[model samples]
Target: MKLLKQIILLFSVGIFIWACGSSPINNKNIEKEEPVVIANDSLEYEITIIDIGFNLFLNTIAQPEGYYSQEYLETRNRIFVTNWNIRARNPSQFNDNIYENVIDYQPNIDYGYDVNYKLFNYFMFAQRKYKMTLGAGYSRRIR
Candidate 1:
């Protein structure tokens, strides 16, 4: 009886150690991500985002295209961009690395659905990856 208990204890410890290993199998097999460009040729606006795992997040985690109306996306983007720009300007108060550049998103100009959708999803990816809130009043727990 004592021997069986000892064997079970060792097995439990081994399983625990294996579970707590630093690198997971999925992380080891991750593919490299390329920069994603958000552009509107007709409007002559372009933005390139180069961040690791953003592509994966965009495709796998974000809501599907057409899940949100363009107007809704634009409204949320306006709020997010305003807060992001504020952080970018005041780097001392926020993480300088995260808010490196200010986005030039004009409220009046129409960027079309693709541009707005990609931009909004990028903001969502950034929020999740950095674990920081871009728009405090807006919901950040989508995922």
Candidate 2:
């Protein structure tokens, strides 16, 4: 009986050790994209986007910096921001996870070409990732 008890205890200990051991995660499949920081010291503005795959999208998918005029970017941004804010307000109606925060974008304040460009690209990236449309009149193949 004593021998049986010792064997059972040894088995339990081994099981515990195996259960507590950490399994190695496959890191190769994961692409750790860094946060995109859009800042303009002159305007005293900064926006850090930490969404995964955004950096990759901006680098590979988004158009070049000078592709879109500043006015065009601002126009699109206004429409996108308005829709985004509405969705954020009504979480029950929209996906709360996707529309997490309401963007405080002022139409009067000129956030510069850089800020507008980045923000517009972010909106584009979010639309593609979440499979949602902010506003109409934009083609699916916009890059």
Candidate 3:
């Protein structure tokens, strides 16, 4: 019994020592590769006026200048909000003057993804409130 206990104790100590002495798990073997950023090549804008429910009378407008800048974007957002309120109050009048009052207005600059997304959301709001069917059947392709 004495010999058996000594052997068990020795085995347990060996296991403990082995466990403690082992190398820690690490990701050193992983190769550190730099991320690749692909620049947009095409001049085509991803967000079309149609996507934002403005295809009725408005032509496809290019991204506004300084659209990437937060201040400029916020200013444009204010304009959109004001227009939205005006349109909401008088849907028929807004629709009639959309071509002359809204469509002709263009931002003289290019914008990136962020501005495009904001415009998209704003148009979506217009569609919902006005009960207009803009960009109908285009949802399936996006998915």
Q: Per the 3 Å backbone cut-off, how many clashing residue pairs does candidate 3 have?
A: 2
By TM-score rank, best first, the candidates go: 1, 2, 3
Candidate 2 ranges beyond 4 A from true positions: 1-31
Question: Where does candidate 2 clash, by residue pair?
Answer: none
Clashing pairs in 3: 64-109, 65-109
Clashing pairs in 1: none
Give the Å error, residue 96, model 1.
1.4
- In candidate 3, stretches whose alpha carbon ends up further than 4 angstroms from where it belongs are 1-61, 64-67, 96-117, 120-143
TM-score of 2: 0.75
What does candidate 1's lDDT look like per residue over 16-39, in tens digits?
A: 998888676566557545789999
Q: What is the lDDT of residue 77 in candidate 1?
A: 94
At residue 26, give the lDDT of candidate 2: 29
Instruction: Sort every candidate by lDDT, greatest first.
Output: 1, 2, 3
- lDDT for position 107 in model 2: 98
Predicted structure 3, TM vs. truth = 0.26
lDDT of each: 0.89, 0.88, 0.45
Residues 1-143, model 2: lDDT tens digits: 99999999999999999988865452432455578998889878888898988888988999999999999999999999999999999999999988888888999998999999999999999988887788846656543
Q: Pick by lDDT: which candidate is best?
A: 1
Residue 15, candidate 3: how far off, in angstroms? 80
